[model samples]
Target chain A: MRVITGREAVREALREEMQRDENVFIIGEDVGVYGGAFGVTGNLIEEFGEERVRDTPISEAAIAGAAVGASLLGMRPVAEIMFMDFVTIASDQLMNQGAKIHYMFGGQQNAPFVMRMPAGAAEAGAQHTQSLEALLYHIPGLKVVMPSTPYDLKGLLKTAIRDDNPVMFVEHKKGYGEKGEVPEEEYTIPFGKADIKREGKDVTIIATSHMVFKALNAAETLAEKGVDAEVLDPRTLVPLDMESIVKSVSKTGKVVIVHEAPRRGGVGGDIAARISDSEAFYYLEKPIKRVTGPNTPVPFSPVLEAEFIPSEEKIIDAVMKLTK
Target chain B: MELSEAKKLKMYRDMWRIRQFERKVDQFISRGDITGTTHLYIGEEATAVGAINALKDEDYISSTHRGHGHAIAKGSDIKEMMAELFGKRTGACKGKGGSLHIIDTSTNNLGANGIVGGGIPIAVGAALALKMQNRDEVVLNFFGDGAMNQGAFHEATNLAAAWNLPVVFLCENNQYGMSTSIEKAFKIKDLAKRGEAYGIPGVRVDGNKALEVYDTVLEAAKKARNGGGPSLIVSETYRWKGHSKSDAKVYRTKEEEEEWKQRDPIADFEQILIEQNLLDEDKIKEIKNEVDAEVKEAVEFAKESPYPDKDEIFDDVYVDREVEL
Candidate 1:
């Protein structure tokens, strides 16, 4: 076992996958000698050569489109968009081309690729900041994955590379520096499985990405208040682990879904709806609560940006509202 | 000049086939047989035939909205192409892809895209894939001057040259981008010269002359296969018909249309072959009859084919069944 930062875990996972399969290669802006915009691909060029760790021009559409074509033709191409906001520039390729290719071609062809990008408001302005998981995952053919811990990021990314489907591996700009335990031996975490980060009884808090840590912190605080909150992290959104979610809800009799994305059409809303839809609905003692970013864009001001992201206090407030 | 007699015959057949296919499509659409929008390749026969002829069946091609010629020239069966347009279940893409999205994976035709310049990036990726595997394959991306303004063109061009990927950017300069003339859209006349920005070679050829386009593309393909990187071949051509069957000739004059019509690619190529003793009147008549019959049967097949079943609509999205679907 080894302790590593989330950033190191990403690089290690890429390195291991590239070693395991020659068909797997990385391509994106500054992914080469520059080591990626966030240094997630550190020194990979030196080991894998420029061909495997290719540097692309500032063309997000081409980057995504090329990934689609490469994957369709039997190569596993992992493309990186510098920021999630820029994913809009490559949306046609991702949504129209990558997502629809498999179905449009009658299963005769598909683009097995991974589109990696850092999302959420990380003190970045309106243009560079966005949490697009809900928007992208809503597509029928795409798999949306958000890894909270170092071990999960490494394991899930490896799985994404191996899967014969297109996956959007979304990361948080702030989470890369966080450290966690990761085994040196190879492993993978299957999609649609929920991780019970903490066990409890009073209430359940369903969270993803940055919100998972926020909910864990809220759970710790709630424990002192005798609330005994359970924290559930559903790593993959497309293949949602409703089994674990509904089970937790049935046990706790209350639920609070947390996410950094907008509340209007975020995955949190879907999770809440599913909880109400399941047998857990009869077990519920209180209405479902959601801690989310407002419908407005993540602003430029520090105070505004801080308020835009859901805090531990917000999570605790939501949990307290449901539990009380 | 170095083309064998058999190759010459193929070149003539391909060019003639595209022209005849498009002619039938227009007639079908006019008679209310074929519904939906279509961008015909009536005058741009040589560009597709010549460029596609220079490519092997294994070599990939990405075509534009006006891509029937490229598809037919790439040896796509007229039956499936017509079936696709007719929205029949027996189409190349199984009816999901109508006229704008005809695909023939058997020949490495990666479907014609509806979005202008959309296919170029896909072609660049195909080339990048070959380059990654050390596979000796080249990609021919056919677009138009209309696509000249599309972000995809610039992005694909830059990526192709930057990676030294084996791809040829074949621009079909039909002088108009859906009624807006190329001169109005660009300051420069030679669309091939745009490749200079990416540090690649760019050359324009007479698109009406199938052999000339074939020669240019052949040279470009050889360069690509040898790892010489990408080149831009601008085939200066015209769209003798309107952009589609829906278009009216309000933007240009009848005089200009007639002027370009006199230099029809089929007539010009037929005369060239006759003078070179590669074709005679009897041989020409036989080829014409064969082409006409093939197109006629293709239309009849398309008309007789069944529409896709309602349940089949749910199929083809994901091979592994990403979800319960």
Candidate 2:
């Protein structure tokens, strides 16, 4: 029973996994002596040595492709693409090779590698701040993980490392400093399972990554207005827990999906479509609403940036509109 | 580097096997027996067979789109490869990966990549894995002259050189990348010189000469295995056929093709074998007949194999897991 920042939770997961398995090594641009751009890999090289904690050139493709190749040879590589936006540079290796290797090779081999991508708007301009889980989730052979809390981050990251498929582990940059209680003992959360942060009946608020916190706060405000909101987090997007999503919506009869990603072709659209297509279609009392970032790139100005990200007030407004 | 008679004969047989196999593939494609596209490795047999002959069975290899020769050189079953091309259940990748993506883990062949330079970094990674585990093994990475222009080629080569990973970067300069000639792609005459930027040793050899390619690769592989780091070797060769099944080959003159065809890798090596008394007329006839029979059997096996079950279309997308998607 200890409270720690989300960053520390990530480091702990990595250290524990590295200690558990020798094949699990960290490779990225600044993951070595520099301790990562966000300080998530601080002092890991000191413990794991430079060999295990590898420092590569500023080559995202090589980092990703090398991880894929190493994973095929029985080594579990945890590759970090410093920012989510830079994943585009490594997209071919991650999407074309890593994601398709297992399937394309007819299941004879699998690249059991983890690519850690720090995402979300942290006042950085468009290039450095973007949630790319939607892109990864669209790929068939990849598993996408986005955790909002320190406890969830530690458990889910450990699971991602052990997973036999390519995993896109998206970490919210803004939530790195957020603190939450995590147990000292070892545990791992399974993929495709939903975590109901707050249980209610009037409406279901489905959120991902940093948006989950806003949804939780909005549920608190909704309770004050005498309208109960259920908060559900489908932590892993690829093996999405549609079962839990439909079950929650069946009881609430209303749903509102929220995320920092842009509205156009966002994961929210997919979730909304799935809900409407599922047996829960009859349970909907109102059209499923989405509170998401606009289709434009993330702005740099503080005021515009604040307006860009989904907020607790916006979630409350969506819930109020549905309930009213 | 004196090669034994047995080794010489094996390399000769492997080269002929690739030639016959590629020729059969051309016939199959023309006859509409195989759908989609395939990059034939006809003229480049010496490069694949010679370089791969230097590697041990435990060593790994990463191949390119035109990788049938690499698969055969690495000792993959031709039956499985033909079946894979036929999209049958008993194929190398269970029909998931066709000609361009054939993978045989049993022989340590990393799947052939569809992207030009995509397999380079993966091969580097495999070498990195070998180094991390303290294994004395090297990975032979096969790419084309066209791959030299790809970002992946630079990134992967730099990483391999920096880490001193046990890998040999073999560039089979087969003249053209689809329709674009290497002359238009690279400013430099020798593609091997690109290794200077990465601080790795580079060598060039007559890819038409199987013995020369074998010697060059053997040396590079030994250097890599000794922790000396990676080497880049440019095997100057050509493709006898067009880039793929759809290519009409309008870009090059028939005279140029005929000129290169005269320096055929198989015939050149066959001449050497005869001169050394390692092979005679009877032995030459015997090898051709044996290779032809093998190709015939492979085609028959592929024809008799059943297509993958329709219900299993969703299979092999992931390992050990079933999803709703």
- Strongest candidate by DockQ: 2
Model 2 complex DockQ against the native: 0.82
Docking class of 1: medium
Segments of candidate 2 deviating more than 4 angstroms: none
User: Model 2, residue A9: what's the lDDT?
Assistant: 96
In model 2, the clashing pairs are none
Judged by DockQ cut-offs, the docking class of candidate 2 is: high
Interface RMSD of each: 1.4, 1.0
- Among all windows of 10 consecutive residues in model 2 chain A, the one with the lowest summed lDDT is A101-110
Instruction: Summarize candidate 2's per-residue lDDT along A1-324 as a digit string, tens digits.
Output: 889999999999999999999999999989999999999999999999999999999999999999999998999999999999999999999989999998888888889999999999998898999998889989989989999999999999999999998989999997799899999999999988989999999999999998999999999989999999999999989889999999999999999999999999999999999999999999998999999999999999999999999989999999999999
Give each model's whole-structure lDDT. 0.88, 0.93
